[model samples]
Target: MLSLGAGVQSTALLLLAAEGVLPRLDGAIFSDTGWEPEQVYVHLERLEKEVATPAGIPVYRVSAGNIHTDALDPAHRFASMPLFVKNGDGSVGMIRRQCTDEYKLKPIKRQVRTLLGYPAGRLPRGLFAEQWVGISCDEFTRAKDSGIGYALNRHPLLELGWSRTDCLRFLARRGWQSTPKSACVGCPFHSNAQWRQMRDHQPTEWAAAVAFDHAIRSGAARGNATGSPLLGQAYLHRSCVPLDQAPVDTVTAHEWRERQGSLLDLLDPEDGPRGCSPWTCRSDDHDAESAVAA
Candidate 1:
């Protein structure tokens, strides 16, 4: 019961673990941040033969143990972090809450605290795990509670009420339709229609997030983990006129709503950095969708 790899909520948590309803198939994690998005590894290889080989469901990956621990760990070094925007001269837009808590929730709380046996380096004396956080109870307030004791979160699409049209009728009764709403092919929560489908279908991840936003802006600095360099400037939302002039979505549907910012403010953002935290996602490496904060 994990489903943070987000191929239609990991095929609706493997259709509620093939309708047994999650007795135990605790797998499908997918938290690697080597700049993802070749259709998120082709929907995690068609969600591992449709949800991990017909309900075996163990597709883990939380790597990032190189490139200098992924560049001082601003969450797998999307060339220095700090998204969560509104700063089109409105000021006050700072992201980087540690890139989904160190590349997606510390390797999913070290694999659900070693499968609830506990004892990983701390905190396992009380609620001895039961994590199950796919979070689609229409995101029941990002369903938090890591008070730390093993855990105790549990949503299972809000205890089987489910929405987003019951996750599209349980992924079209397993024929499936769409998925791809996870993150990190330059994920500033992409939505100028997912940055025109990653510059019209993955031009090498839109030229590697426009050469990683011009290689972290020529000197690299998103400071203030007590380093004191940033002043709120990083562009991966394509053609705010930065990363080598990237702004050509052929805008003429009335200038594409001034380059997009109000489908209910990118799905209910009053501040910004929108929501998608199945395991641990503040989501980052910006392209420009919006909403997934806290």
Candidate 2:
């Protein structure tokens, strides 16, 4: 099974499998966070109709729940995202992220178990499935073992010595040049350019992200249990301000300097197009408070 993120790297893997360049895949599993930009869903549909389906591969859609809805519900035990926090003492911090594990990985693992014809608990001995991940050579640091014995993680891209550039080129040659990075619409890890892209071209999703940013200002609910309320406000943007009012349009001095250099230097190492995958989350080493300070 291929862990299809519907992003550049994963999409390339899917296409390779479809074209028989890679081994035939039994299926592709996309674990939806329910807050991805509309383009991701559209791309998934196109892949299913024009690629995967034609190649005799099934695509499975699984989800634990709608992350946006769950985060807002007072009754739900909110799985926290790494929301930028502003304290009354004028210090910045971030909530520890659990959304990736709960919303993304758990559902995909459950589906894998079911596909393996085993119950939710332990898998039978000596029976494991080969699960392909889409980590490329450029992002090799993100690659790791599956940890679980039931599913062995595979990195075909790394084996092929492919990079993100290679994936983009392959897709562009196949007439899929506009594949959007796959991440939740309200992901706090979004760079200013990504936010600007959504704001300028995808206003509906941008508005939704803005509203979600505002809604989470008071921080996540603690269900019906009695607990200390959040001492500071939360924000979706690294600026620790409201998303709509963030400095998305303003080119920072750092960005300006990078823009003056070669094309490769255009991407900010700290704030580039790091799409979130179920296996390779973009928030790996992100420090929201430090980002705000910088």
Candidate 3:
């Protein structure tokens, strides 16, 4: 099974399989967070028409409900994404994210199990499924073992010596020139440039993100496992202000100069550079806790 993220690299991987450059896949799985930009869904349709159908490859989309509600739902008590949080000490931090695991990985695995005729969470002895992830050569460090006996992770792009730039170039040659990065609509991992693009080209989504930013100021009711609200306020923009009013359009001269190598650069936070899957979220990295909110 191949994971189709609908981003450049994963899309390229799917195309490669369709063209017989890689192993023919049983099908591709898309784990939607349910808050992806509209363009991603559109791209998925285009892929289905132009690639998946022609190749006789099926594309399956799975999700554990919409993440927006799942995070805020009091009954589930799932912690909301740690976008950008404002602490009482006047400093900002990001919440430790659990969304990818809860929303992305688990559902995909469940579907894979169903397809393989395994009972819920039960696998036959020594039976394993080979799963392809889209990590590229430049992101080789993000590659990881599946760590589960039921699934084994593979990175074909890395083996092919491709990078994100290579994937973009390949897609451009195939007449897809504007493949955007894959991510949820309200992902705090987006850079200022990404936010500006959303505001200018996708106003409706930007507005939704702004409202979401506002709604999380007190954090989710289930932010803590114990059902307590967060100690800090949440904001989508790194400035600790509302998203609409945040300085997403322009970076100050000081900010531009300082942001280049600073830890606060939200555009390419850890687990980014490429879109993330549960295996590559880097949430386990101890340093991410200390990094400034995106």
RMSD of each: 15.6, 3.1, 5.0
Tens digit per residue, CA lDDT, model 1, 46-68: 77766566877677776544322
For TM-score, candidate 2 versus 3, the one ahead is 2
lDDT of 3 by residue, 1-294 (tens): 987788877889999999999989999999988888898899899998999989999999998888887766667756457577778998778887778878888888888888888948567898877899888886688898877788889999988999776777788778776666788888776656677878888999988898888877888746554557777888876678888888776543433543454332232312223455556763433232223233
Where does candidate 1 have its weakest 10-residue lDDT segment?
Answer: 264-273
lDDT of 2 by residue, 49-69 (tens): 999999999999999899999
Name the TM-score of candidate 2.
0.91
- Model 2 sits at a Cα RMSD from the real structure of 3.1
Deviation in angstroms for 82 in model 2? Answer: 0.7
Would you list the C-alpha lDDT of every candidate in the order shown?
Answer: 0.55, 0.83, 0.75
Superposed model 3: Cα runs more than 4 Å off: 222-227, 250-273, 282-294
Better model by lDDT, 1 or 3? 3
Q: Please identify which of the two predictions, 1 or 2, would achieve the higher lDDT against the true structure.
A: 2
lDDT of 2 at 212: 89
- TM-score (all chains, Cα) for each model: 0.33, 0.91, 0.85
Worst lDDT 10-window in candidate 3: 264-273
